[model samples]
Structure formats: structure tokens, C-alpha cells
Target: MRVPVSSKIGVSNPYRSWKSATDPSPGNYSMGVDPNGGQQIVIWGKEGRRWRSGQWNLQFFIGIPYMSNNVSSFHGFKISLPDETGTMYITYKPPTQDLFRFVISWEGKERQLKWDDDKKKWLPLQSEPDPDNKCELYNYCGNYATCDRSNSRRICNCLEGFKPKFKDQWDQENWSAGCERKIQLQCQSTNRTSRENGKPDGFKKLKCTKLPDLATLLPSEENTEACGKRCLENCQCKAYAFVTGIRCMVWTGDLIDMQHFQQFQQAGNFLFFYRLHHSELDGGRKISNLVIVIICVVVASFLVASLWLLWRYKKKVKVSSMPCCKDKDVAIFDVSKSKRKEFSADLSGPSDILIDENQDNGPELPIFNFGVVAAATKNFYEGNKLGQGGFGAVYKGELPGGKEIAVKRLSGNSGQGLEEFKTEIILIARLQHRNLVRLLGCSIQGEEKLLIYEYMPNKSLDNLLFDATKKAELGWRSRLDIIEGIARGLLYLHRDSRLRIIHRDLKASNILLDAEMNPKISDFGMARMFQGNQNEANTVRVVGTYGYMSPEYAMEGLFSVKSDVYSFGVLLLEIVSGQRNTTFRSSDHTSLLSYAWRLWSEDKAMDLVDPSIRDTCSPNEVLKCIHIGMLCVQDSAVHRPTMAAVVLLLESETPTLPMPTKPTYTFLRSAIEEEYIGDAQEIVSSNDLTVTLQY
Candidate 1:
């Protein structure tokens, strides 16, 4: 198969399948770069992630150990991440490029075919998931569990010092939850109330295997010893692996998608160390009966004393800051009674498709009582209100510590705000990024649902981007920084974070600005989660603003990461041109997109720059952003570039980027206001479920 390659994502990177066996249409499968970008590839199916090509070890995909046995020149496959000088590309040369064919089959399998002139047909040379071993499937053994096909009867097994999370499920051959530690570590962890033990943690080494997915790249280490030492010192680090091409990589949280390999136990062939309790590393030592009895007696006495203290503490906590029901969704925390209030969620719900995600995510979210929130916002005085939007009104407040906070108060009457309130509480609490707004905590009392965030002194992007007096304060360079920040945040949502998120509503109003004028993407209530390798999903009830919605999502309720990209493109153009997507009107164009495209086609792209920064803006930088924005707002989702690509445009290996086709023309604001409502108030009402569609 012939394919164009690049180190950067998006352009000439992905290979998608036909709709069906005979019908030629786009299917739900694609072979593309790994979203996590660990120098590997991933194949996504209609369901989720189907398979991965393992990690790159300079020679080949380390996951494909058998590749070492093949002496064919097929090893010409090479990939390099783009650098400042544009030295990035992914190139592959088969023995006969013209005769070889590559395809993502309609049946959701990636295939490499060789044309046989003798037989007058194409012959398949390779396929993923191995077909023969069901264990090859993605996360078949779940977290902290490895699938070993060598064990025909039971392929799934937990590592030493671990046991199945759910014994009943494991007994029934369901290892999705995988395993849990048999004993607690000395340092801080979910199960541990605090750092109690004095002993240090240790590591257990394993032989060749596919490294766990989503490994975060770390700085270069002199050797595996240094890598191990660095990971071992960090409390969050769970495992560490060192590869040839890619140096040190450390995995935090639960490790998933690990497999067993038969490669020889050598220096660089997939030897990874998993973290465990130091006691678990004892070399099968036996203790004397008398010594064991003495230790047991001492531990019993300590437990008795600890239990009494724990009971008294729980009694005080249960009186106020906890929920009445074990499976309750809301907790009436009384922050006024204490400086810190704890979250009471014995349940999970649908935000990014999983509620209360993990121990590291849920319990960590703080809870502010209604009394404290009310006092901070001066009983929600009219003057304290920052702004009112689809979700509700945001109020500026301050804690007793003099820390500023922005409280998003869900409208009691608007049923729409309730879901959004819960969503923001779940999604933002788990997400950690500078470009993304930080969610401090939540407040729930009776009908009040309030989400507390670190207050942005400069307010939202729309506050300055559209304000006549404040617009010029953000220069051309600052505007570019805002664009890049938003892109980074969007990229994190889609590819970097553990959760694959799609922000359905991404616009100027939703972009918040810090005191430093740095941009942070906010308002995740309309966001949805994409599980595993899931590319797209359909919904009947559509949400979000009109002009920002993607064509497919607005008309058919189909949404994905690309939907956010389209919205971002619109926002990007607005940042550059200082014009709203829906309100722009020119002599020959009705919307901002059409006007920008018209200028670009006429070689007057410079005319699209916002008047305020035109004098100070670098023409080259401005032109590059406009071109990228045009690519993002493409009418067809297939043609739209991924956020990862947009973020990496600076490092593009090619000197000249591809020219973007004419974008899908946006709506005429005059017609919208005439047909729907007279003002912006009615269009973006407090009830967020307002869906305006064309055709």
C-alpha cells in the first residue's frame, strides 16, 4: 500500500476503512497515530480501541517481537517527531511500493496486501489481533493484568503481590477490573488514609511484554537504573520502562493493556519494573512462630487503639459533611462548620461516560457547603454576578482564606442546568491542565447546585475579545498565545488526558482568561466522553451554541473530538479577525468563515487580521494561523484536522502546509435573529437544551 507519512498528526497520518464489505462508504474503523503518541500506532474500531502496534524500539514496534525474525527490507519503516527545524516524518518503503497495498477493512481490521500478478488478486500478508488469540484484544485482562496466550486454559493472570479486584468476576472469567494490591504500599495511595508506614517502596521486574499504554515520556536517563530510581522516588509512579528510541517512561495510576512477551531477558528488550510494597519483595523468607506470635499480639493492641480513634472521627464527619444514602448523587456538605469539607460520592454517573472516575479523581474533589458559598457571594447579590449564560449565572466570591473563587450557580428552574452542574463537577475535578480552568469544589444544598472554580480576575475571553476598550490590550502575540493555549487544552481533552473528551461548546464566551491574559477553556457541561478508541457517537438531544456546532452534530446529533475542533476553528478565526462567527457581515459574505475564505482565495489573507493588531502582528504568523483555522472549519469532519495536528503546526516537517478547501459557510445572523429571536438573550438562554438546526 502507498501512503504519505509525517511526524505530525493529522495530515497523511490516518488510514480509514470502507463503510461495508461491498458498499464503498466511510466505516467506523481507522488505523492512525496513537493519541497518546508513545512512538507507536493505534487502530480504533466502531466500539473503541481495538489494537496497538506496541512501542517503537528504533528497530520496529517492540510489541511485534516476530518482526526481528523477518530479514526483509520491510524494516525500512521509520518515524521521527518533528523538531524546530522541521525534521519530522513517518516513512515506510516496502520491497515493491507499487505492488503493496494497505487498507483498513470494512470488517474493522487493518491489513497489508501484496498484489499477485500471477493470481490476478491481492493477497493479505498481515492482520491485527492475530485472529487466533482472543487475548490479543484490547485490555482483555484489564488493569495490572497481563494476557499470556501461552497459557491456553487461562490467559489472564495478575502480577505477584496482587489479587483480583473482584473475585467473583475473576472466577467467572471477567477480568475487566483486573487486580488490586494484596497489601498497601508504605507511601500515600487511595486505600491509605495517610502516609503511615516508615518503610520505603520497592520494585519487581518482569520479562518481555508490550508496555502498558499511555506511558508519559520523561527526561533522558543515563540507564535503566537511573530511570528506576526516578520513578521509585515519586509517590504517583506505578511503573517505569526504558526503550532504545524512546528513553525513560513512567506510568501513573492503574496500568492497562499490558501483555506477556517471550523475548529473552536482556538489557533493552522490554524489561520493566512495577512498583510494590517493600515487604512484598521478601525472598520467600520464613519467620519463627514465637516471633510471629509476638508481632500479632502487638498489631492487635495497635488496631484496638486505632479503631477507637477512627470511630470518634467518623462520628463527627457523619453528623454534617456526608450523604444520608450510600448511593446518593448529592452531598450536603457544611463547609461553614469546618475549613475543609469532604466529598460524599459512593456513586458514579455519566460525565466523560464514567462518574467518580477513580480513587485519584473522585474523593479528591472538595465539597463546599451552601452556607459558606452563600456568604462568599453576599447571598448572590446582583453585583457579584460575573455573567449569565446557557447554564446559569456565575458569581464572583471569596473564601475565608481570602482566596478568590468563581461560583457557577445552576438555575433552580432550568432542568438543563442540573445535568451540566453534575457534569462539570465530575469532568473538571479529574482534569488537570494549566490551559484548562481548575475546579476547586462543588456545593449542593436542597435545589442549589453550584460549582466552585479558581476565579479568573480578567474574566472570560469574550470579555476582552469583543470589548472595544479591552480588545487592544491583548496584542497580536498575546492573541496567538491564547490560540495556542486553547489548542493545548483541547488537545489534552481529546488525546492527552486519560479521558477522551469532546467539548461540544467551544467559543469565545467559554474561554476564560487569567490575570496574565493566558486562556483557559471552560464550560465542560456540554462535553461528552469517548471511551477507549471510540471515534464518534450519536445522540438525540443536542446541546451547545448554534454557530459553534459542527455540521454533523448540529443536524444529526453525531459528535466526536472533531466536533470540538470545528468549534475551535471558529473561535480561532474570531480571535484573529475580532468578529463573531454568526454576526459577521460583509459586502459579499454573511459569516466570518465565508469572508475569511473569500480573502484567502483572493490572496488577500492579510485583510482578515483584526484591525486592532494588524500593525503589530507578524504577517507570517497571522497567515499561518488563518490557514490552520480554515483547515479546522472544513465542512466534512473527515477533512478537518485533529487538534493534535493544529497544536503541532509549528513543528510541521513540510515547508508548505496543505491548502484548505472552502469551509462550510456559517448561518446568516440577520436571518437567525429574524426567524428565532430578536436578541442574544433568547438564543443563549439559561435553559441550555436549546437546539437550533438548519435542514
Candidate 2:
């Protein structure tokens, strides 16, 4: 006979606390799934939610990323969607021989227990909301602060450019007051328009961060670059972050619940905040005046001393010289003095020399002798040649140890001279990343300058990406991976590395693929380092590849991280469509950018995908990439996403993407032809048909 309960049976809340084992009355604490249907298990205090298991993502809960891997073997735990009964449930099948149980203690700690037969007692296997990880505590560090587990002394600290709001409270270990910006944002002031006229506020990049809370989702039509511009334009915007799954997330007021992770942990998110230029931040007016004063004084003293010395030297020279014309002697003396002055200036500023070979100083990098490089490359034989660029020809070489290497030998007539060669050695040698090409060593003898790198068996991305025969080998997955890899490398250069670098010539050819088909960014001859919050710089000599150059960079000689983003965008489009941006000419459009804009506007974006990979590629993923690529190639540098955002967009399965505005169709056939002619004459003659346009 079945015993029937008098009352209707309902699901018991684990969060509900019991006064005692004998007392059936419930206490204040209660635990249950979130009623908002967010797929998170939450424990509630008398007031509100005390703690929550992060949002579930079908496979595992995101907050505890390692949960699935750790618990799968012991208990096959799974969350089931609502069925016809309209009831969502979580279930787990225990191992046949082992016994286990779940429990919520009086203190609101949730744990899984396993029976140990030998001990004849229950053992706690795992616990939710681990107290040791302070991040698990809600708003543990308060607003505008990030909790870092790696920091043993203090887990909480304000974000860059921020300071404690209540100094006394902070010192007393009370972080509830949070922090505030040390300097008020220029855009927030009444004289914002006038202040912005001189130098607009820019973003300070923060890497490896957990995004803050209460982020407003930007419009679907906005890219990360546009998102930044929008935030800068608005006085209310405090900080912004862009991730793959979550598009553009801008925080107004105070940023909350942020965290920083160690290098080994997964910290892919990047945060940017509006701030005055580095000069302005540190009392620019006073500093500038003082610097100018000191420089003028030094210059005046040097000039006076030089003139006196020159007069004495001339008198001595006249005494020692044979009878000659006074004017002729004076001219000869002036020419010799000028030559000496130039040589002295060169010695004073040794930007090109990482190490002085003549001084017997140990080089920052290994120096391969000219003879060794020549022998390895078979005496620069044509058969051993790998590729050629504006710098020079790269040849495949094998060392005595059977180690393969790629040697880049600069041509005598190459536009990239000793300056660029030294730049490559200095920059590439210091930079270490999986996505970046490894610089083995260098060789400099007489007029010969060579940069040795780890040999890439697959060669450059263009070798396969553009070639119809080899394009098939790069399936949709491989192509996507390649794009992501390139993005990560750029991100490293722009944000992660010790030095902030802008790869002025980021293109398909510069992207070399390793044996595993992994893309490694090569060729740093054109790269520039930004020191101490210096984001953008200008040069009279504009040097970069033609099609990849951003509008501001190509036209006005202004280059920054965004310039690289524009080139990456162009490369992304090229990879997707299997066409060169400069050479692509169709009946409907003059260049690939124009053609893509047309297709995107007409809602025929899929048509832009290479037909070869259409069958294998995910339509959504391809469309997203196309949209992201268009965003990157936009006319305004301010409207392009950073490399960090690009990496997230490519890697994350973020459903929604910002709509791409009509990219500037600036590719003129005559202009392209003119640039091509100029490049061909000025740069190295290459069979690859690529040109580095220098204005």
C-alpha cells in the first residue's frame, strides 16, 4: 500500500536554513535557481542575493570554468531545459558503486559529498563559491577596483588612473566606498569643446582584466572603435570593454566587480578609459616651460664655447698652413668642421645601435658572421630564396646542427636602410610571443645585413591564402584560426608586450605560417615603439603597404595602433574573399573594399565569401568576420576596433555584431597605379608583386 502525503509536494529550496535537526522551522538563508531564468544558481540572504554560480553555458558554468572537467567523471551532472511540464531541472547520475549527496549547510555553503567506505564517513569532494578566491564574493573590491588573486598583500586595487574614493576608509580596509578617477576627464568639464580642440582625450589600454559590471550594451551598428569614440564623446562613460560573446560594453558612473588575473590564467578582456594625454596628466605647462628653459641655456653655452674653440683652431691652422688664399682656406675649414659636427651628432644619438660592435660590448642578440650566413644560404643562391620584400630577399638556410632558418638579406639598393635593419633587430629581438616570428640572430659585415628567423615551412599566409591551388588546404577552420592567431599577435604587440608597438606594415605576406599552419607575424622593419602613454605619432615620410594603409596614415602620415587594425581588416577581407585589395578590380567595383561594401549593403554578404570554403564555413561566422573586417577598414581611425577587441570577436561565439558603416571607397585606379610605380622605383624589385608605398 502507498502512503499519501496530506499536502502537495513542492521543490525544496536548498538555501532555506533549518534552526536545528529536530526543529523543522526555516531560517533566513535560502538557496534556489534564479527566478529570472538566467540559468544561475543563487543563494539569497534576508535582503537579496548573497552569491551566485555564474551563468550556465550548456557545457559548464562560466564562473567555474573548470567545473565540467573536474566533476564529469564523478557525477554526470547536466542542466535540462524546460519540457512540456515547463519545469527546468538539474540532474546527475552517480557512479553505480559510489554514493554521493549534495547539501547546503546552515552557513549557506553548498558542497558535494562522496561516501568513503573504508573511512565509513562522507568526504566533501567540492564546494561552490570557494571563499579562498575572493572574487567569488560579490563586489569584493567595490567599484572602479579590480581583485587580483596574485596580489598577496592586498587583493583589491583601483584600476589605472583611479585612486581610493575615501582614503581613510581604504586605509582602514573598508573598500565599500570604492575609488574615483584621480584626474577628472576633460570631456566632463564645461570647457570640453575648447579642451578637445587641442588634443582630445584618449584611451589607456588595460590588459588581462575581468570586465566591470553594469555595462550598457552599445548599439548593434557600432564596432569597438566606434564604441570607443561614442564613449569619449559622452561625459558619462567611465570605462569600456569589448569581448566576443559580449559586444561593446560601456560602463557609466562607477565600474564594479572587476578582477585581474595572473599571466597563466585566462584574462583575455581589455579595458579602456578616457584620459588626458600623458603630458597633460603630469602638469604639461610647467614641465614644458622648464624643459625649454634648460634646453635654451645648454644650446647657448655650447654655441659660445664652439665659436671660441673654432677661432683658436683657425688661428693655429693658419700658422701651420702653407701660404694659401684666405677665402679658399676658410671655405675648406668650414666644410671640414661641418663634417666633424655631423659625425659628432651621430655618435651622440645611437638609436640604431642596440650594441656597439667596435666597443666589444656583448650584443643584445647573437651575431652570426657574414660567412656563416652565406654558407647556410648556399652563397645567396636563387634556389634557396624563400621570398622578397622591400627590405630584401629572404632565403631558407640550414645550420650545421640541421636546424632550418630563414635569412633576410638586405639588398644594396633597398629603401629600408641600416635604420630599418637596426629597428628590426632591436624590436623583433625583444618581442617574444607564440604568434610572432622568432628572431634567431643577425649578421652584419661590410654592406651585408641579414636577419635570421625560424624557418616557416608553410611560408607566408599569402602563399596559400591567395593561391587558388593551395587555398583549399586552408579550410574554413584553418582560415579562422589563422585570423585569430594574427589578431593575438597584434594584440601582444599593441598591449601585452613590455613595449607598445605599432606594426606599420601588417599584411598577408608579413604573416608567416609555421609547420603546424599557425600564423606568426614577421617583418618588423617598419614597426614603431610608443613610449609612456604615447599612442599616435606622425612622420613626414609615410611608409607602409598601399592597400593596407589607413586613410589618416596614408594621407596625413599619422599612425598608431589603429593603422595596424586597418591593415588587419584589409588582410581579413583578403583572406575571406581570396583576393588582393589593391589588385581586385571587378565590373561593379574598383577594389575589394568597395566590392565588400556593395555586397554588405545589398545584404549579399555571403557572396563575398570565397566559393571554395563556402561549403565548409559557418554562414554566421563568415558574415560576422566580413562585418568585422569592414569595421576595421572604415575611413576614420577612431572608428576601428583595437587588436584586443578583434581577437575577442574572432574567437568568441558572440551572436550579435555591430553593423558596418559604408567603408570609404577611396581606391582609385590612377592613384593605385601611381603608388605602384613609385614603390617599384623606390623599394626593392620583388616578384611577389607587393608594394610598400612611401610618401
Candidate 3:
């Protein structure tokens, strides 16, 4: 069945029916490249062409949308042209040196399979025309229609601005007749010169879509806008799209074989479909503007009334009755006469008081005196120094009542400045949870900005988890409790709290431990609040420690709750193995995640438990935790479980956990340190290295 280098290999109708297990005869189906040098690989049925592998685009077969450059990188797929001998061939170099083959079965299913050493059988890596989504069968929806597998009722649907050509057939679940444009294109009747006189057509942006078949690449146009103008000038142009690698692509005929993907499923490509009329866009814009105007008026009126009420209340209230004045244990002062004058001269403002008062309707934080804080810390001496963080040096301080506190004194040269200080106040002041650090109050005078928090006697989890001598204190049960506590805190931030939050810098050191050894998540500097149901966001300035950051957040500046989940996964693995994800190395495994994954795949997951806790650790519990950790570190953010799911899996034994894929292995300690260390300053020195960048 091997075709010569210069010859064509194909399947024909008569060869497809040979069903004998040991039969050397061909079946009723035939497949091969067209000998006329069309480059497309076609499978022929008894009737006509059944399927096709669209012309090669150097990296992949254009017909298969998911066969991307990454697939080539993983499988080493390539199409080689013939030499003077006049032959061409398709080949692949497997990721591993495993026995492999490409075959077309009796059912006409083309598949690429590899021998599975463990299973002792051939396992198909890829099969053409997925059975579940029959839309992949070429032009399943016919002309001017798109196919979406996510659509439950029917896989085929008319493209936007179109309607089914045959309404009866559409209702009957027959889409062979496809669809037609609802409004006639303006260019149909008007000439290019006359088109400028009336409302011109425009493009409707289709986010994350597979472009239709028969796309013409416009190389002369450097950008999309230019290509758009070119398409608009042409009377027959139906659609256009701007692709990163291919640049401008235009379609003149009906759009076919189109597919739409959700935001999470999309790689990078999008299709900009042309609209037949300007009214299609104008109607939506008008409604949006009206809504904006109404919202503005309501918000403005509410703000004015609120301000008037506050002003009237302030006139009748006495300063002696203020909450800050009533608390005897808390001291409020301006620190020094010079600092008071400076604060009054520059920083004192009504907005500051308003923000502090309105934050989640929480209690107003008492402003501490700089002098009193300095005295408690012995004039900010080195002896009282507890630790240094991204913000500045933290010192151990005791109030007059012998109440201990950790004072985070902001440094002028530190990456975290007044903005982060305010963020910490707004977030921590309102959050009240057992596993969350408590912010007592803050002090702002002259150039000093400090945050006071209830001191944790045992310091942070990293202090115990990574220290060989101290790690033994954390038995299996204790570590499991710590993991559960952290999960609860994260769950609260993501779902239970009034405001959804993403703790971008979740890590071992940021998790503080109380005297009872309960884990408390600290450091709200990099936390982001998501209003309503907003789950993810993007930022150009990425802030967080290396090793603990998720792949999306680290490489693309995209983050969500799943980002925190990824960090938690790394932390969980570290807690179980008593090893640092970034620093741990062995003869066979370069990183802790790699090592854990190897052990899991080899059914040696119990071996990953730390020797200190091995005697007490339950084999099933440890294995389950490892499995959950691996799920959390999956490459795709969508694949990572929500914090709620993680918590349930940890607490209940009723739910069966899904199998985890291999963890993303892009991170290597040496390479990451070399690339990022020079650009960032070391903030916290512990078992884990935390770095912060000055923007």
C-alpha cells in the first residue's frame, strides 16, 4: 500500500467493501491526492467526492481548522514535494519513536494511529470528520451558512443578516438549500461611484471564527482597513477578514464551511463579515447611546442627592461622636506638627474620606499616628524588623495595651506605592474571613505610608513548609487542613463574597499561618475585583511572582480566577512533596510539576508524598490531592476547575474526579530566572522568591 515517491496513491469505490480481517483486498472507498497537481487530498465515494483535505498552507491542511501550527510542532507533520523524479508525499515524525500508521478503515474513517506501549494496541491520535459534529463533513450547512457544534437544536445556522432560503426545509431540519441574504447588497444595483452617494455597507465583527472557504489573500494591502476598502469597492465581495499570519483575506463567492467558536475555544483568528446595509449597525448604536445617556443622568442625580444629604448630616453631627473618637484602644494622631502641616497642605482631601467611608459599608479604619507606630517599633530600628515585602520593610510592633501588630512601612524605592496601599485598605478592610489576613488600620503622614495588620505568631506557610527542620511539624492532616483553608479563602473571593476577586499573587509566602496553624491568605496589593459576573481580564503590566503565575498570566498578561487556581495547584504540590516548584530538581525530573506528573502517570503517585508525612498520610487522600493539583495546572485555563469545584472535590467523596492531562511544562527555573530577574527587584526573601517590578 506504499505509494512510490513520484506516484499518486488513492482509494477508489470498489476497494472499500473488503471487510475480511486478514483480507489483502481494497475496500469500496478510495483516497489520494488529485494527480492533476491540485494539492488537495480527496476521499471518493461510489457517488462523488465525499471529503477533502483542503490545499496545503505550508503549516497545515487548510480544511482542518484545528490542525494548527501547534499540531505540527507536536506531531512534526509536513508535506514534501517531489524531486525531478516527479513525486510528492505527506509524512509525519512522531513526538516519540513509536510505531505509527495512517489508514482508511472499511467505514471510510481516515485516522492517524500510534502503538500504545502500555495498552498493547493502536490508539488513534486524530480522525477526520468528527462523528459528534458532523459539520466537519464539508459544507454540511451549504452556502452562506455556518456550523456550530455548541448549538444543541441544529448544527447548521444561517450567517448573521441571512435567512434560510427554504423555510419549510429549515423547519424540517434539512439545511441542504442553505440561506440567502435578508437585505439585498447595496452594491448589487449601484456602481462604485454611485455607492458613495448613499449609506455604504459595513463589516460586522465575528469574534473567533473560522474563515469561509475560497478565501483570496490580498498581499498588496498591508493592513485590514486597506483590504476592507478594497473589498467594499468590489461589487461581488461577500466577506473579509484580517488574519495575523495570512494578513488580509477576502471572499467573493458565498461563504461556506464556516464555523464559529466561543472566546475560550478560539486561538486567534476572527472573521469580519460584511453587512448589506448601514441601518444594521445604526439601530444597535442608537439603542446603546440612549442607554448610556439614561444611565448617566440617573447616576449623576443620585450622586448629587447623596452629596447634599452627606453635607446636611455633617452640619448636624458633632466631631466628638465620630467612631474614631469613640474607640479608646485605637490611637489617632498626625504623628508630628511638621507632618500634619504637610498632610494638610497636600494629601488631605474629601475624596479620601468618602472612599474610606463607602468601601462595602464597612467600618471606617482609624488612621494611626506615625510617631506612635515608630515608638512601638523602637524608631523603626533593625531589631524590630520582621521581614521585607514588595511594599517595604515590615516591623514587629506592640501597642500600649500590649497588642502586637505587623507594620508594613512603605519604602520610597519599593515597587508598591500609594495606589497599592489604597487598594489593600479597600480590599482587606471589607473582607472578614477566618482564612484571610485582617487589616487593623493604616497611617499616612508626610512621605510615610504604613498598613497595620494583626501579627501572625508563626509567620507564613513558606517559613515552615520549605524549611527541612520545621516542615516535619506539618503532618499530613495539618497540611491537608492548610490546603482546605486556602481553598475556602479562594472560594470566598471568587463566589461567596459580595464582590468577586482574583488574588493574582497567590503563593506559599503570601499565605500566613496563625498560632493554631490555620492558613490565612494575605497581600491584597495585586488583587483585582470583578464586578458582577466578570471572570477574566487582561493587563499589559503583569504583577506577580514567577513560578507561581499561570501560563496565560505569565506569557500573555491574561488572568482570571483560574490564574489563582493554577498558583494554588503549584502551592498544593509544593505542600505535599515538601519541594519548591521552581527550585526542585532530581536526576529524572527538572521541575516539581514534571516530577509529580511523571509519578502520577507511572502509578507511583504515593511516592510524591513527603517523607516527613508519609507515615501518617492516607494513600487515597494523597493520591486524590495530587490528581486535583494536576487538573488545576492544565495548560488551558478553561480546563482548570473553578475554586468551587476544587473545594467540593477536596471535601466530599461522592464526586468522581476527571482524569487530568499532562501539566503545562513551559516553565523552567533557570530560563525564567535569567529572563525576568534582571528586570525585577527581589521583594521577599523566603523559601520562595517574590519579585516586583516598578512600573
* Candidate closest to the true structure, highest lDDT: 1
Kindly list the per-residue Cα lDDT of model 2 for residues 28-143, writing each as its tens digit: 56776642312455566667655555444444443453463454553455665556656657666775768987665554555778999999999977544354476766677788
Q: Residue 81 lDDT in model 3? A: 62
Error of 1 at 32 (Å): 50
TM-scores across all candidates? 0.52, 0.50, 0.48
Model 1, position 430, has a per-residue lDDT of 82
Candidate 3: regions farther than 4 A off: 1-330, 333-363, 667-695
Q: What global local distance difference test value does model 1 have?
A: 0.75
Q: Model 3: per-residue lDDT, tens digit, 1-695?
A: 32333334433222253432245376556766543322455666566565666545455554565565245333566556676666656566766778887676654556677899999999877544464356656677778887788888678888778899989557645577899988776667447665557677777777545566666777678888888898988978888876654567788888876665534223344356665666555463456788999999999999999888766664332222124334433444423334334434443322322332343432245568676688778888898898877678989898775768899898987787665666677677778777898887788777899888989888989889989999999988799999999999999998888767788889898899877788999999778777665767887677877777887877678999999999999999999999877677566655678788888889999789999988556666788899999999887899999999999999874469998877644335434544555423432333223333322
Sort by TM-score, best first. 1, 2, 3
Worst 10 residues of 3 by lDDT: 315-324
Error of 1 at 650 (Å): 4.0
